[model samples]
Target: MPRSPGGLETLDPTRQRQFSESGYLVLPGFLPEPLRARLVPEVDHWVDEGLRARSIAACAAPEAGGPPPVLELELAAHGELLTHPPLLRTLTQLMGPSFVFHHLHSDRHAPGIAGKPWHHDCEPNDRGDPALRMIHALHYLGGLDEKVGSLAILPGSHRRSADKTALAHLGTGEVPGETVIDRLPAGSTVLLDSALFHTRRPAPDGPGGPRYFIDASYCQTGARWRPVKPYWRHMLARARELGLSDSRWPELFAERHFTEYTGTV
Candidate 1:
């Protein structure tokens, strides 16, 4: 529960060591109120308007063709969040000054939704360097508690060379040494090494409020990471055109860091 070093303006050595050892960092209330307020309504629109469904369809059958009408970052609040200066600074502290934006996903999980099995989200890099890093910033817009699902992560799991879903058989069942992160204020963000194993456990109660979640990922430079979406070029281009990455972060939205999209690995 070490909160974000307020704006992550200064990455203390202790916090850096904690992230290196634990493979994750919890930044409770990392986002400011205004940004989080804007994000909430946008997430409602994303889900209620069926844009999320259409985006899922596009990814499910890339060969079926055509990109989704909107990418998550194209939404005003989402676009702002993507390059939120404080966030970029925090990321730079962990992955160095150079890194590329990987992808962004926004969703609203309804009450009583089933749990997702334990899995790591790391995608492969053409270089196959374990030292290279891909980090995911998980935004919990409404925060988390028993009413919403809990996130359970195994500390130090990212060091293992296991397949992404190697622990799927265990489902959301408790695992020894796991860290359960169920209590946080609204606008918190948990930064994780994308290879770390984690699971989402459905709320224990029968019914509860929705969970507003959005995740965006980035990769350390020096290797070409796999692209999750077929329209990767368009995504990168739009980010660049929108000036998401400013002078300080030249590589944030660059396309050179990704390999060609290879349909839903």
Candidate 2:
């Protein structure tokens, strides 16, 4: 298939090395203006609706009716944003030829919201090969400055041990090493390995503050697994429309199966 336009076809050798060593890479103006302009209003409307419905505390509280309905609305509304051509192309380049969307979420933090605890995405998983499991794309819809809540991450932390003690420190809100707060302007994107230690600090109270961005995760699909239903049919149709079926259909529709081994006791 013809790759999407707007994303870098090849990372510089320096960047490739940096990504290999640190498990993260920051690209300036990753999302072009046209795409960002299309997505921002949708995000703003969702956040405004959330603010109107309840306070930040209410949304954060578990008993306050599982994540305000707007959260889901925001997610569903931005589904296309998750699949933007440039972003998808870059991800394809990084993760090889095939991958699937794992999850999509939107985080809108108004004034008074508590900062998230620092932690790695790998904490919830027990996979033997965590490195190849997942990666994330965080899209900034508005300016993320120091005053407003911004993502802070520990570069190269993905290689660190996911031990109880380390997890405890992060859970208790201990600042991790060499914090880098992503100060991206509106329309930029940051891609990071899921295993990296990171969190979004709450926005400070004031006028024209920062809000959380839509964060989407993707993972390499395992052999014999279909990440989404009707995967083959959907992609095949898409590939045909794009004139990619003849060239890329096979790789796109490839599948695998494994047999279980059982022995008599």
Candidate 3:
């Protein structure tokens, strides 16, 4: 793929072909220094706050609760990061002309924090057609390496079936034959198909060390968008307050779709 000048090279014909065949590609140091510096601190702050909140909640109701809430920052709140020039340009190239920020969130893997299961971001219930639903961006904040923990993805696995056992084994240091561990420097960003099988490793031990990264998933605007319940309610009220006519409700609420699932094993 031809690298873009003054930007991470747009996935060139060769690179695009590779991605089509392989299911994932890494664009190293995609975000420039200044924007990365500015965004990293904000993401770090949000993750820290989320961790603290999760700790308190766990203490208050240890047995009743499930996993800690993965901190999420809405792009609407982080406008500068969302509208960053180079990132946006790259996204446009990857996803084509029209796309929407379907989801934006960050994860902070503290020491001993359990690693994530291998899973595709979009499954049958939620993903649109694979051809139009192209890329997701994972931005690394803290320095990442094998020891500090990094993302693990299955190359060419996007077209395969979702494996429950494979998901369970990702963080257990038992990667499947197709897996690739992404080792990235701080400020580097990786773009991959959301349907690709992937997982995050737990934080390794060290003073002043933890794994922090942001996952931003996008889909072509032509895809249906689904907001969660609370957000949907908020969107309804916001629309009314803005004096939007009822006719526009469908468009306003168009992106919100819910997923159905069987009981966890």
What is the per-residue lDDT of model 1 for residues 58-84, given as tens digits with 9 covering 90 to 100?
989889987899989999999999898
Stretches > 4 Å off in candidate 1: 1-8
- Compared with the true structure, what per-residue lDDT tens digits does model 2 show for residues 27-95? 666766776776666666666666424534433443544333333223333655666656666676677
lDDT of 3: 0.57
Worst ten in a row by lDDT for model 1? 1-10
Question: Which run of 10 residues does model 2 get worst, by summed lDDT?
Answer: 256-265
lDDT of each: 0.92, 0.56, 0.57
Q: Among these predicted structures, which one has the highest TM-score? A: 1
Which wins on lDDT, candidate 2 or candidate 3? 3
Q: With candidate 2 superimposed using the best TM-score fit, by how many Å does residue 126's alpha carbon deviate from the native?
A: 8.0
Please rank every candidate by lDDT, starting with the best.
1, 3, 2
Local accuracy of candidate 3 as per-residue lDDT tens digits, 1-265: 3455664546567777777777776766666677667766666666656663663454355456453443233322344454455566666666665655554555566666666777777633345445556467777765567556767777887776564355665454656566655477677777787778777666455433566666666666555544322233333344344433234123322334433223222
Candidates' RMSD to native: 2.0, 8.2, 6.5
